[model samples]
Target: NLVPLLVPLFVSAFRRADELAMAMEARCYRGGYNRTKMRQAVITTADKVAYLLMILFLAGSIASRFIHILV
Candidate 1:
């Protein structure tokens, strides 16, 4: 019963995908051809420090959740 309904749905999805691909090809879309970013992405020393601090904080949180403090 469900298979009959799903066959058309699958065909419709594939048809739409094919149509989109054709349209994109017709427009000469080369998928990231000549793509340029306005500002170049760079990871500086400060970014590295921030990432290290984030990792330490996450590790601290996980340790606190699993480790019990003994006084």
Candidate 2:
């Protein structure tokens, strides 16, 4: 009962996917060559400060656990 209905749905989905792929190929979407390289992100002073804070927080969390065990 269900197999007959599901077969056509899958066939149509595959056909649509083929059409979309052809359209993208025509538009050079992620195609080989001539693509510009993305700019690299520079770490600013704020980023460095955030990283320092995160490291400090992690160290404090671990130290607190050890201190609890000692006490």
Off by over 4 Å in 2: 1-37
What residue pairs clash in candidate 2, if any at all? none
Q: What digit string (tens of lDDT, one per residue) describes model 1 on residues 1-71?
A: 99999999999999999999999899888867787668988999999999999999999998887776631
Best-matching candidate per TM-score: 2
lDDT of each candidate versus the true structure: 0.92, 0.96
Task: Compute the lDDT for candidate 2.
Answer: 0.96
The candidate maximizing lDDT is 2
TM-score of each: 0.46, 0.52
